[model samples]
Target: MSHDFDLNSPENIADPYPSYARLRTEAPIYHSADPDLWIISRYDDVRAVLRDPDRFSSDVGGLESDPFNPGLEMPRWLTGLLSRISAVRVLLTSDPPDHTILRRKVSRAFTPRRMAAWEPRIREVTTRLVDDMLAADHPADLVHDLAAPLPTTVIAELLGVPTERNDDFKRWSDNLINGLLTGGPRIPMVRSAIAISWFFLRTIRRRRRDPGEDLISLLITGEGDEALSQWELITFCILLLAAGLETTTNLIANAMLAIFDRPVLRQQLCANPELAAAVVAETLRFDNPAQGLMRVTRTEVTLSDITIPAGAYVIPLIGSANRDPDRWADPDEFLLHRPNLGEHLAFGSGIHYCIGNALARIEATAALEEIARRLPDMAPAGTPTRITSPVLRGLRSQPITFTRTKIPAR
Candidate 1:
């Protein structure tokens, strides 16, 4: 299919669903130059790429430029440095035995028992955030006050960081994550990465010497066949902090962003707080936090008669797949009560599925239920702004107002 598909265009970044619709219909396995990638947009095709890790390798690093914007390509040495960070090849970026070992080393931290133990604290944090938002007279920004802080606090607590250092941790995560979406070694990101890496290394070393009952301590204290190296621990901390903070924040903010404009939906949520889970499920399908993830072809692979060469970058558009007409009834509409809603690829699939998804769900569900319970009449005070990244998707700011004001809880 000869079509003009620019994955990084500002229009696509702002709202890529239209272009996604076109891709799924006309070219299921479309390839584009500039930022050269084999874009897989169909539900089944994207699922296949995700399921078969052997043929589609996840050991992707050395990304030179914004896969969406080729103009921002970095210098050769800069790209080489960025590639080393990518080359760490642990967890999501690593494949097979390495990934298996790394995942196993840290999997205990996210056990159902641990999460259930953490639920009360999650609710406590959520209620405090919502209360503070409600107590304020002027409109509150969900992204800043509630959504961001809730996850940031929980993840910090999980990692055994002092709550006083949450802002520092968040700033560090923000810079690194923004750079990740852009790719390569931008000078600012490089500097920030160095600072963040140094911070993590120092913290890891300290925790290893004096281990605590935190996830970082758990990763650092591994002393058997699956023991993670120092660098691996550093990488794990970075991934856990970045993923846990941003994704849950995005999930809560995105769900509320959708509900803010739709009064009926808001009313429904207020009417039945149990529907908060349903709201979360639909938001993930409608406007997920991440649109796509990159994978390299282990060998030449074919989908829809299009042969992708070995080592080529394959992008499975999760947002596009979630909206595929073949898989969804009204692919465009953000309707709740979706029967097959649980099947969406927002959390991804297979070995690399989001390790923090269970936590994200717990956080978002708690945030939503509390928001619905507390600010039943919350409405948009101004336009909500979305984060501008080719890979990540969520609101950067969500200003909102509510009719009822409750006394702030201590």
Candidate 2:
């Protein structure tokens, strides 16, 4: 407890589970000094913060999170303008009625039936991607060939946008996500955000005239009550694009990495490909993609009898919460059949649960199953790179070699 719980420390970023264990034991409501925030590492306490947005308003609190604007260097005027906006601008940075309305507008995006409609597309993309990856089989970078593009491609198709523009999406997505995670230059990501927003605005206008089955068109055609204003529509589209891409990309990459050094686990998955879901589930728990989400405290609050002052920043670490010793046995191990797996906060909980949860599950599952079947001997080719982030965790590049097997027909 005497040592600082440095969330972004090199050691913590390398392997936060140990520090997280110490946090849960020594300071359940630990506060970090560098960025000035309180961290809630225990499961019950984290769940309480996420589900209770009243005392911890995501609107004002969420704005300070400044996730999109890395280093949070916003002009005074822009910060002032955010309040007068018609609705909360972004889903990830909004709370209550506004957040509620925004989320509800696109809630049906990944429904069971809708997912069934897209299941074939998911499999097709996964198969084709895997085939393409295996064709270049010797020491392929899974992050490049497969994980990075699959979700973005599906999202593009889902939005009725052209996949040929994927290069632009990739560039924009990288700048935006990297900016937030790494505290890198904000100008590039801001430019990327503008470019993507402009693209979505034009697409939304087009969809209004000629509706299609894609998510954007569906949102365009949404009736009263669920109708999205121009601002809301643009924000929602950006959220879907960013969230859909990064979360699943990281999930698949992390899941594959979990089994990378463990040959027994890889071979186990090879024999029982159906355990793909379990692999994804345990990866989420073992190394969830979304490491932490920020919230600002509206009023004073207490956890484990420790007080968090009003207007303070709070981070309920999803990565830390899942691995809290109080919650699971052998908390660090990546067991595919960990009981009560759904309890993990990978997709989060309450009204803000990820809209793409089912899509991520199925997409990652499909990716895993096909890889197991085709590249059953997949192994790490070299040192895999970890993303240097306190809030997101996954490999940036993973060199993997695998046996060439005939691509299976769906």
Q: Which of the numbered candidates is closest to the native, going by highest lDDT? A: 1
Tens digit of per-residue lDDT, candidate 2, span 235-313: 6777676577778989999898788868888878988999888899899999999988777888899877999999988
lDDT of each: 0.80, 0.79
What's the CA RMSD of model 2 in angstroms? 2.7
TM-scores of all predicted structures: 0.91, 0.92
Candidate 1: TM-score?
Answer: 0.91
Question: Per-residue lDDT for 241-340 in model 1, tens only?
Answer: 6567777888888898788768889888888988998889899999998889888898999888889999899999999999999999998888988889
Residue 363, candidate 2: Cα error in Å is 0.9
Model 1 residue runs over 4 Å out of place are: 69-88, 182-188, 407-410
Q: Kindly give the stretch of ten consecutive residues in candidate 2 with the minimal lDDT sum.
A: 74-83
